[model samples]
Target: MTEHRCPVMIVTSMPYRLAVIFLAGLMALLAGTLVARDAHAQPPHADPAWTDIVVGAGDDGRRLSLTEGHRLVIQLPANPSAGYLWQIEQLDTAIVARQWSSEPDYVGPGDEITGGATQQVLRFVALGEGQTTLQLALRREWESEAPPVGVFTLNLQTVGPFTGANYQYTVPPLTQPPALSPDDIYAEGLPTHFSWCEQGKCTPIRDQGMCGSCWAFATTGVMEAVIKIQDGVERDLSEQYLVSCNTHNWGCSGGYWAHDYHQNRVPPNEPDAGAVFEVEFPYQAKDVPCGAPHTHHEKISSWSHVGGYGLPSVAAIKQAIYAYGPVSVGVCASDAFGSYKGGIFTTDESSKCTGANHAVVLVGWDDGQGIWYLRNSWGTRWGEGGTMRIGYGVSRVGWNASYVVYGQTPYMPIGGATQPRVRLFLPAIARGGGGVAPDAAPVPTPTPVPTPTPTPQPVQQVPSNGGFEDGRVIWSESSQKGWPLIMNTGSLVIAPHQGSWASWLGGDHNEVAALTQSVQVPSASPYLTYWYWINSADSCGKDVARVLVNGTQVDTYDLCAARNTGGWQSRGVNLGAYVGQTVPLQISVTPRGPVDLATVRRFAELAFEVVGLDYRDYVVQDARFVRPADVDLLVGDPRKAKEVLGWEATTSFEDLVRIMVEAELSNPENA
Candidate 1:
């Protein structure tokens, strides 16, 4: 027992040492766990602890918050007067983030920063835990008239358990760095400005979706503009005829300019007979023989090709601009430009010139800096807000390289000898009123007076306040903001083939009827013709819809015969042709195939007074297919349509669905 006790005592020191070591290790582990838990609990960059403030134009500064792991996103309107500068700062002490001044600064063109208003996005991450204050500072760089400077500031505070998902990252800021100083041009620049001019336009090769018809789009765009300036009236030349009927060139895929011009002899003054009336074939990326004859004849005031020598210099370009508004030009393919928004240039690296690419117009040049301003076709989102300025003199990016220019020549000018007026062929008059007589005249009748006149009840007039009623009525300027009450009972809807409704099909029938909530047509005039769209299963025949205008039946149509199916289909119908005069428009459907009648769909847009209005306005409005909420979110904050347009949703989604269902159920065919 004594020996065992002694042995245990000897080992006791070791056990004590081991216990101390284990205790220390345990303490270290506990400390690490605590630190990790603290780290895990931290919120995202936009957490209240990391936030500052929120501010916008005409908006009060307010506190904003971020849930854990999320950040905050802010949008600001671009202001050039103040160099388009927008800043966000931490209220504690430091300037956490600032646009323009910060790294990767974005400085737009002086004009953009001043006169052209655009959208700008800014993002911030939560820095830490607790309440954080944010401050916003905006400066207008263009207010040179008033002390040359104006500043606006807003402050906000936010609390956050921030998550990263809450905020979108702002694009790295752009800097309006000066272009490289000009140098002398070399022989390599010959192709750049072969036909350069200050005022010239370039029409992009229209991507006739799915149709390998870039050649036709290019040809038509140039010719259409040419004809317009020549005739003093804008004419929509036909690409279909060029693609289909031109004999010497490939129908689709790629074709040269000379081949298209020579092979396709566009007739003059007969646009409707040859060009406008031709039906568009389904656009296909691969070449297909011109399948069918265009209903309209090809028309041209005059056509010629003018080839020139080496690239035109800046002076030459300026002269062209002074002479003509804009001229079209062609340049080498610089990049994989799926689309572009600004002016044209010859450089391969668009990133250097503010992201410009192929096919554009040289609208004007600034003599002060020798910069060539180009216009692009990709709407208005690309380039310097859809325009670009390139260095002119030294052939920067090959501006002096060989290029093609198209404009109205002396022979093509309005009222020139070569120009001819278009003559329309009206349809033969038909008998009406049950053929009672060929020319019935009113019989002479004697007027009777002095009969006991009953006291006439006083006619009451409702005060003519500017508001829309639920029932169908002619659109008035007062009700311009309301939803359109007219319905498309026609066979097709005309929209940019790229529009959202291009593929929209109604229920099972080849007809679709959307809620006529608060849409407005161009005007209330009965003579206005509107375009609509439809599709067919086969090329032979397709029934689109049954239309009733003011309780009278309208003709049915085979959609395939009238429009292209693979691309957007457009058909214009004179509403005045139906119901003897334009009145309440109602539409229904009857099916042509085994598909559900209710599932058939189509799209449409109204064209009011098609004569004088620019088609661009209609195209722009029709192309905007964003949902109402989306439009409001993008266009402006606190959208004013409710007050300005007097628009409000009178029907709910459930109610709309119910009405559709009831309509379907009421139809014996659907049942």
Candidate 2:
């Protein structure tokens, strides 16, 4: 195993005076003088299983089939009317048994007197066998532990063992993951705050309008943080620059932040001239055509994926957020998510998850309080002052997290990962599952947007939302979901180098994710150019990213780029030969190892002969092949067929000459 050393906290976005003061106050709070409040309803030395719920938030209908030894937990929102919290009322204690539990662990700074948000957690395990209902409710006193304000019930079934995929709505049934083993300074502390208020690196929340452009908004958030930390200036880079122009993205419909920030190395539509100022290319929240270069010249050096799939700990997320400002994240956003008002907004499995996709930023996490401070793009009208304090493990907040650094530098894996294991990051953006977006709210810009002269015509447009935006609109998948390629390995993210989205194609063993689309070229001199980012854990992975034109292979890039020029690279191919030909364009990637970024090296921005081209979105299906029937025949390679008949067979040579050979051999009269 490689030693994971913490990066020196050398780059402080603020002056030493401010940093020192913040550090001092936090240190004092964590000192021995810090008081540990007594466990509210439950005793202090409770079982570790007492707080096992880690993924799903608080919905009651959550399905569960816990294994014999595995633990289970239930967490709910609490209202503190005077340090008042909820406790377990009563249970059968037969089929479902309580090992231990805890009252709401409150953590807001000064809201105790005003009844701020609180979270109540309880732990349980399957007693013997059958399924049963676990019911509980709120009460002011602990002795009674009953007479509920609102009844929260969930079914608990004891199954053989957990084998199904962990599909969590909120925090996926809060379960204890492995412990945090990091070198971060704040890894072992209490009440660690990394919000914009504490670090001054994060920017104010901005609305993404009625558009599902959270990916772009999240990307801008990370970029804003990177600029502040590197140069001490906060710039609200243009999401509009991402909305339009980024050919791989479909503007408002939805997009991936990671690919938009890193993968689209060579945008076929417009030039990437760094992060544009807000005034230069302001947000319209609607899909608009590509526009000219807006004013500012600020651009990111590069961005990279951080953290592993099933990321081990909350501390890991906090470490990166503290070190790199706010990090972009994707979560399972539900209608419950849309109507969140205040406190640590939690999730449950009972309510129909109206919206399954969303992107946000993790500004901070409070260990002492058991909550994650999230900054949403829905403007200031939602959550607590435009932010929400969510229970720590809610909705994969820190999962698939990304961070940006200023200036062009080589891209690397998150956690400064140097292992040789191939990584298959899943795609980060998709839409249509939109719940009602908060109505328009004024977006306050702390930084001034600059207006500059713009010029230059855009290159011709091409079909295929190659970026995989628009919810698989232009392309179709050719494989089944249980296949290796269908795992969580490849994912859409908000880290594109140019647009707000790009496709993620992870390699899989034996199975292939063949995404194909058919299009007719509109004019002559048709050309193909695209941007791709790569990552590889080791050199042994067979995952490969390929570009195929007309069923013919054009080029292939592997996950080994981690050893080469290092980050995103753009390549071009002359399509003059097929300029007027209608054909299917296939972009396929497959990985079979620890992960191979064959792992999502997307083909974005198809630039070529512009004009109306007969195009069709094809559903990606597994490349199916049929077997040949048995025939007592043998054939020789007939090179002379081309000379005599002036023809060749698109079918196999064996099939073409099978009948001729059988007839000639059976003609005894010739002998």
Candidate 3:
């Protein structure tokens, strides 16, 4: 219009201007994306007032004011496949409140199998004005002897207002995977039926009595899933362990599936959950207070939240179950749910099962049936024999689901690095296998023995091919029920006292095995010599081997309580009495203790029942008509002790335990 400026400079500037505008817009878009990512790196309630402590920072102690909270960000070097886990061992809730914990953010240097790590932000708020200590431990939950890898202790205080605000803090930007859409995960295909139970990866069905402790069972289910998915090991995790120790839930009064799954939970007088076996902490219907933590067999490293507590997508729920093993979910249990048996249950949309009242395990899903599988805790007598099937579109079940991770490395809280599992491949062959396997060394067959020329040889070898050097040639070995003794044990460590090959006579209690051979000692001084080893190994073991010569027992030996690698023992007997005679020689070994799991478990149960026996009524009244004075004599033992040895007993053994326990109950401080 201005007749214009068609100059060469103006013509080129148009394209340049457009390029500049495009670049500016692209940069702004990238900047916004980075900012959004950084915002999510921190916990939902990250406050400047809260102090940050890197988990492995060798934190000795710290102080906090009653008016502020603190964050303990742990960058755990985790490998769940190894069954390692981290847990909060000690924390006094009387002085501090474990506010929340975020889902683990896994970050690998490259890939998962090669190397990877996890980041977790655990938030804690000081409750009242007092001093307390927080402790952490890392270990494998399933092992009985696996020691903790390390421990982290943080001494704290809330006695006064802020004093030292000079410690500058820096938070590492979290390396987190992007929020995944369920739709994206399911774009390919969904399995018809995917139950961990079908794969033999789930634990046995358990009952929760009359208490509404579905949440505890759900927690254990997820834990079992984690163990199975990560390590391909199906462990019967203790639901009773969580029911008694996890204080975050209301015990038998109930717990929530969506609540923090053990962020600050600690075992009483112990280090962590899964510390005790189910047999040790049997489940009872009542809301009993926690018992003293004993020898724990399982442990966990940390746990995570899936889709959070509210408004989670069903797609996300399904994706989580696929990625992690099983998931703990919340469902609205209604009148219909109480009577639900076997069938695909779809809540009548007009009247739905509404109210987040029950918790269960989201073990699997079926696209054909359009339902999700729920493993219930109401015993095998109810529902689909302890499992339920629900519709897919239902919102209640997907609302809030969680997952936990396992840890194999041990934690040394005093600032020690994690170590590989110590009890690797240490399964006790005595558990079920008939014969014990060699502990360390593997034994193969030795060189075969050839027959000598038929000369006037006075004595044939006492144990011809005893070491199985020629593969069960002369010695015939058999166990209870005609099971063959393990003749393939070629381990030098477990070999005969003399040779490299040895036979193993191993089984549960009450099972007997024998090795016999016929020898013609047709000469003077017919001496018998052999090498043998025996071990009871476990509390349930009572192994024994006997030397029987011609139906007469010459000597007997008892098995030690463990793998007796103390070298084989040698024994020799002079057979000069039976010179120029042929006799039957037999070596019989028998497992005279508990035979199976049921039998082994009975001993512990019997001990517990015996300890809990209440015989107080006998002290005041006579119920037995025969030999009642023995009871009286037991009642008068204190007087007798006073007369003899000047014992002047303070109390009887039973009375001492009862009185001590009573005194502790009256005054908890004594405990």
Which candidate number maximizes TM-score? Answer: 2
Candidate 3 lDDT over 1-671, as tens digits, reads 21111101000011111000000000010010000111123443434555664555344454434443455555554422122345567888756655432332333222101101222234466555677888766544333255677666777776545333312223222222222222322312223346666656788787665455677778777776666655777666555656566656456545554223233355558654343556777777556667776565545666667756653565566656665568877664432455566665643221222334456788877643346788877667666787887665442665457766566421112111323222112122243554333333222323234323122223243445533545455555554445444333332213222222344443333435555555555353254533333333343234444555544444444444332312222234445445555555655555433221111122222333354632221121111111100100001112334456666334433344456555656796755
The TM-score of candidate 2 is 0.35
- Each prediction's Cα lDDT score? 0.30, 0.45, 0.45
Ranking by TM-score: 2, 3, 1
Candidate 2 Cα outliers beyond 4 Å, as residue runs: 1-191, 258-266, 309-312, 349-356, 407-671
- State the lDDT of candidate 2 residue by residue for 1-671, as single tens digits: 42121100000011111100000000010010101111111223423322254423557667677665566755566433121244555566555665432232332312111112335445566555677776665543422333456677777777654332221211222222111211221343222334654556667779765565777888888777666766788677788877786766445655666444333353554455556678877788777865774544666555655665433356667666655566777654433455567744545321221122456888777542345788877777667776887655455555567766665322223333333232211211223663222222222313323223123122123544443334444444453223211111023221333223344444222334454555554453254544343433435333445556654455554434232212233233444446555655555544323322211112111100011211111111111211111111111224346567867545432332444445655799856
Q: Estimate each model's TM-score.
A: 0.26, 0.35, 0.33
Instruction: Mark the regions of model 3 whose C-alpha exceeds 4 Å error after superposition.
Output: 1-193, 231-233, 257-264, 273-275, 348-355, 407-671
In model 1, the Cα lDDT at residue 170 comes to 28
In candidate 1, stretches whose alpha carbon ends up further than 4 angstroms from where it belongs are 1-215, 247-252, 258-286, 295-310, 317-326, 335-358, 368-408, 411-671
Worst lDDT run of 10 residues, candidate 3, spans 18-27
Model 1 lDDT, residue 118, Cα? 33
